[model samples]
Target: MMEQPLPNPILFHPLKHHLGYLRDFAAQSITWPEPELRKAFQRIGGSQLDLYIGPLPSLQIAEEVILYLQQRHLLTPEPYRQHLVPVGYRLCTLSDGSAWALRWGLHTGRHVHLHPGRYSLHTLRIKANHLKTALAVTIASIKYNQPISLQLLNQVRAEWLELPPVTGYTSAEGLGKVLDLVPGNA
Candidate 1:
């Protein structure tokens, strides 16, 4: 049998509408509001909190942390001291605006030379019933953790931009078509 060519996947930029959807999803997913919840948002086109990492130790570290977070979400932010924790976590959104928290490190870590180290990876599914409470917990998680780095920060952003938006379709045939495309420098 002859080989058939694949259909061209949709190529596009990260749309603000999609990002807004992600932020809303994240906010709704967490449900319960907290004092830190406002700060947890990583602003994108406007009030949209696409993906939030941390107040890394410095701009460099913040950048790294953002990059790492980007691999999973649609929008992210530049690193800032205001956001740093002893560690870092990402509240991310799918390209289409579905939200989730990329929890890094165990919620608790031992001090290393007076600096915090050790991270864990976890994913908590969002539920309409407990969105508010979950968001409160996410805020607490990022705030208490240690900082991340700029290299990894940018990595997260790069990764996010590279992927297509999340949609109702499942299986590789859906959004998976982007996998065959080459990545561009963000």
Candidate 2:
């Protein structure tokens, strides 16, 4: 039998390929202030945003993009409340037993729990940095075409554990529900 070479892995740029669509969606859905939105996009690098471009538009990506804009102060609170809060609610409400959903639930929970403006800028910056670190790990995993590491999963679990007890809000209640669903949590 003749030897055959292994096929090359297909390389896909998740952000690069989806940037146009994302920009259009942002422009249409999010109300940005004057030229600030344009400035924000110029500052954002392809690798800075992690999007999963698939057959369907991903709510996850939308949430992440909105969060990124929120973090940068490029958009007003209305968009975050309008877009991200709803997505967070949906994610937490519909989360499953899979680890992927669990991670996303935690992500959404954190954002919902620590909404910008509600918290002090100092606190929001600290939490945002933590999220950015976790996102960097995810981006690296995607860049290398590798599965997410157990360490990263543990880190996410730790962050979930560290979340303060839920308050009386419906969104927080949804997050609390997800907390109860976390494996090993009583």
> Best candidate, lDDT-wise?
2
TM-score, model 2 to reference: 0.20
lDDT for each candidate structure: 0.26, 0.30
What is candidate 1's local distance difference test score?
A: 0.26
Task: Give per-residue lDDT, candidate 1, residue 93.
Answer: 35
Residue range 5-59, candidate 1, lDDT tens digits: 2111111111111222233344343433443334333222222122212222222
Worst 10 residues of 1 by lDDT: 177-186
Clashes of each: 44, 0
